[model samples]
Target: MSNVYIDQFPAEAKVIRAAFYSSFLALALGGVFGIIQTLHRTDFLRFMDSVDYYTVLTAHGVFLVISFTIFFLVGIFTWAVTTSLDRGLEDIRFTWGWYSLMAIGITMTGVAILAGFTDAIDMSASVLFTFYAPLQAHPLFYLGLVLFVVGTWVAGVDWFRSWWAWKAENPDERIPLPTFMVLTTMLMWYIATLGVAAAILLFLLPWSLGLIETVNPLLTRTLFWFFGHPVVYFWLMPAYMMWYVMLPKFSGGKLFSDPLARVVFVLFLILSVPTGIHHQYLDPGIAEGFKFIAMTNTMFLLLPSLLTAFTVVASMEHGARQRGGEGYFGWLKALPWRDPVFTGMALAGLMFAAAGFSGMINAGMNINYLVHNTFWVVGHFHLTVGTAVALTFMAVTYWFLPQVTGKALWSRSVALGQVVVWFVGMTFMSNAMHRAGLLGVPRRTAEPQYEGFEFQAAVGSIGELDAQIALGGVLLTISLGMFFANVVGTALNGRSDDLPANEYAGALSGPDDAPLVLDNLKLWTAIAVVLVIFAYTFPLLSIIDRGGLFGPEVIPFPLTVESATTLGFALETAASTSFESAGEIATSALTAVMR
Candidate 1:
C-alpha cells in the first residue's frame, strides 16, 4: 500500500537536515559563550575582561540569535511550504546561492568578532546585538550583517517563488496550514529586516568609517529597534507556528480554530513591527508622545499573543479530552506523556507563554523604568526567547529526527532528562536575574560590583541562584550530548527501509477535506511596511534638527554617573529648557550627547 522508500526520503528533508546541522553548530558555539558569560557574571570566571566579554557576547548574538535561528527557520519554512503544496523544493538555482551567502557571511562575521576587529566601532563595552547607535561595531561587522540578512532575504524569495509556482500548477487548491503560517512569518521577517538593513548600511557603517563625525545615534537606535523588536517575533513565529499547527494534532485533536490562527498571524504583521519605539522609552531623542503611541500599540500586541496562548491551551485541552481526560487538571496528565513530541511542545508552550506574559510588563512605558537595562530585562527575555523558543526548536528536532534519518531515538529517557534540566535551569537563572535587578544589579557587564548597603545580603542570595543554574546546565549538557548521539546513531545504524513513512503530524482535516491555498502575504507585507513607516516617521524626523532634537553632539564618548542623570533632564529640554539654565546644563548636555 505504501511505496515511499527510506533512500527516497524527500529532498526537502535533506535540505532541512543540512540546515539543522548548520543551526546546531551555531547554537553549540553560542551556547558555549552563553555559559562563559554566565560564569563571568557570577564571578565564577573572572579572568575574562571587557574585551573578551564583548567578543563572546558578539559571537553569541550573531551566531546564536542571528545565524542559527534565521537559518533554521529558513529550512523549516521551505520544508513546510513545499510539503504543504505537495511539491519538492523549487527555485533550486537560487537555493545554493542563498545558502552560500549565508554561510560565508556568518563565518566572516564570527571571524571578525573573534579577531577583535569590532573594536574599530568604539566597542568600548557595547555588547548590544543589533548594536544600536550610540554604540558601534566595525564596518566589516555591519557588512557581514548585511550579507547575512541578504542571504535570508534570498531564502524568502525562493519560498514564495516555489509556492507561487505550486499554486499556478494547481489553481483551485487551498494551501496547507503549516505552509501558510510559514509564508506569514517569512513576510514578517522580510519587512522587519529592512529597518536594521537601512540602519546598518546607511548609518552605522558610515559612522564607523568616519564618514560622519556624528550620524545621529538616536536615528540609528530608532531604526535598529524597528528591526530588532520584530526580529524577536520572527524567531518566535516558527515556534508559534508549530505550537498552533502541530501541537494540537500531536495531542490527538482537531485544531479548534484554524482560521483564527491565520488571523493572529495577520495581526502580528500589523502590530509587532511598528512598536519598536517602546524600547526607546528612556532615551531622550524620541518624544514622549511618540513613545506613548508605541507603548499603546505594544499593549494592543498582547491581544494577538494572548489569543495564541488561548488557542494552544484549548487545542491541548481537546487532546486531553480525546484521551479520556475529564477534569480541568486531569487533562494535564491525560496528555501523551511518553510521546516526547507532544509532551515537549505542550510544556514548552506553556512555560514560554508564561514568560511572554512577563514580557508585556517589560514592553510597557512607565513599568520599563523599573527594569530598564537591568537583570530583570535579561531574565524576562531568557524566559521567553531562550527558554520558550529554544525549547520549541528542540522539541521539533526530537519529533522529526527519526523521520528524517529513518532511525529510532537512541535514548528517550535521556532526551526527557535534557528538557527537564533546561527548563529547571532557566527558571532558576531567570528568577535570580529578576531578584538581582531588584537589588540594583546592572546587566551587560563582566562583573557587577556593589558597595556596602545590603550588598552582602544580595550576593549571598545570588550564590544559590548561580548554583542552580550550573547544576541545571550540567544536566542539560548531558541531555544535549544524548540528543547528538541519538541523531547521529539513528542516521548511521537505523536506516530502516521497511519502516512506514512518518506522516507529518498537524491540524489537517480528514482524507475528505480540501487543502488550503498558499495565500500571498502581499497584503500583510504591505500593511507591515506601512505600519513600520508610520512608526518610524516621527522618531526619524527628530533627527532633522540633529542638535535641537538630540542636543549638540558632544563626546569623548562614554558618560559618567553624574553626567548620566544630567543628560536625562537635557533630553527633556526640547519640551522645557529650564534644565539648560540649571548651570549644570553642560554636564547634562554632555551625558545626553554621549549616551
Candidate 2:
C-alpha cells in the first residue's frame, strides 16, 4: 500500500497538478523568448527587428519570474502546508479560485505585452519587467498585475486559514517546519508587495489611463525597489525550503537542526524588505544617508544566507556519513549523485554560493556604481533566480511529477542530463555576461556594439564573449527541450502501484530541542513590519517632498503620434502663456519708472 500524497489528499493533488502545468506552460513561453533575446542580443541570429527587443525581454521576464516561479511556488507552498499539517485545505473550491485568478490575470498581462509585436492590437506594453515610469505600459498591464497580486494575497490568506484551523485543533503544538516557512515567507511577501501594489494601484495605473498627468519617476522607482529586492527572497525561500526539507532526505539523512531553519526564515522576513534601496544607490533623488542605511541592512541579510549554507551543508554531510560512508571528504561519494533530484539541487546550491559572492559586490553602494545597470547585474541574478530558483524547481519536478501522477519517471537518465546541461549552459552564459559587464558592456539593448566606440576587453575579445553567450543560450534551449520531453513522457506513462511514500526529511534535532520563541509568528511579523517602517518612511517622505506626488512636466516614452502632437501643443501653450505674463510684468515696471 503506497501512502503517497494523491492517495491521502486526492482533491488537493488535483489543484497542485493544475498549478504545476500552468507554470510549465509559462516556462515554455518564457524559455522560447529567452532564447530569442539571447540569440538576438549576441547577434548570432535576429528574426525580429531591433525595436521589438524590449517586448521579447518583457515577456521573458514576466512569464518566468512572475508567472512561472510564483505559480510553481504557490503549488509547492500548498503541498507543504497540506503535507506538513497532515490535513486538507479548508475548501478545495477556494484553492481552485485563487489558481484561476492567477491564470486569468497573467493571461491578460501577457496579452498586453505580446500585443506590442502587432500593429493590429492598438495596444502594447514594451515597458520591460521593471515597468519603470516614463516608460509607461497600457492600462491593462497594470490592471493585470493588480489582479495577479490580489490572487497571491488571497492564496496567502488561504494558507493562513489552514494554519488557523489546524492551530485550533491542536492548541499546544508548535507550527510544523514547512508551515513555519510558508507563513514567514507569506508575511514577507505581504509586506514587500505593498510597495509595488501602491505604485501600480495609486500612481502607475492612473497615469497610464490619463487620469494623472505625471508621476515622480524617483518615487515610482523607490516604490518598485521596495518590492524588487525582497521579491528575490520571495523566489528563493521556496528553493531554500526544498533544500532544507527535501535535499537531506534525498542525500539519505535527516535534517541537521529544525531550529536553525526557523531562525533563517525569520531573519529573511525581518530583513528582506528594508534592504531594497541597495538597488538604488546610483539613483539621484535618494540621499546618501538613506542609501547607506539600505546598504547596511543588505549586509545584515548575508547572515541568514550564511547560516543557511552552514546548516544545509551540515545536513548533507550528516546524510552522507549515515550511509556507511567513512572519512571526511570520501563520504561525499556516498550521496545519491545518480538521482537527478539530488544532483540538480546540489549544483543549484553550488551556483548560488557563487551568486552570493557576486551579490556582495551588488549590495555594496560604492562598488555597485560600477555595474549598476550593466550586464554584470544580469549575470548575478541569472545565478540567483535563474539557476538557484529555476534549477531547483526543475530538479524537484522529477521527484514531484511521479508522486502526483502515480507513475514512475519516464527517464532518470534524461533528467540527469537535463540538469547538468542547464548548469554548464548557465556557466558559459553568465560568466561571459559578467566579464562583458566589467568591460562596460551595457544591458537591455538590441545591439551592444556602438558604431564609433568599441568595448575593449581586458582578457578575451568581445567577439569571443558573444560566441560564448550564444553557445550557452543554445545549450540552455536544448536543456529546456529535454526537460519538457521528460515531463511529457512521464504524463504519458501508466500509473504504478509501486512508488515511494511522500515525506520530507526528519530532523536529527527536532522542534522539541528548539526554543518556543522561534515559532512566535506574531512577534516576528510585528518586528518585520517595524523594520520596514524605520527603513522606508523617511526616504519615501523625502522623495515625495522633493518631487511632488505628481512630478514636474515629464512626458511618457514610446509615444504615439497623437500623444506626441498633444504634448507639443501643451508645451507651446505653456510657453506662450509664460511669455505673455512676462510682457505684462515688464509693462507694469515701465509705467512705474515713468511715473
Best by TM-score: 2
User: TM-scores for all candidates?
Assistant: 0.87, 0.94
The TM-score of predicted model 1 comes to 0.87
True-structure RMSD, every candidate: 5.9, 5.8
| Candidate 2 wrong stretches, greater than 4 Å | 559-595
lDDT of 1 at 154: 86
Where is the poorest 10-residue window by lDDT in model 1? 509-518
Error of 2 at 220 (Å): 1.0
Model 2 clash pairs are none
Specify the poorest-scoring 10-residue window by lDDT in model 2. Answer: 556-565
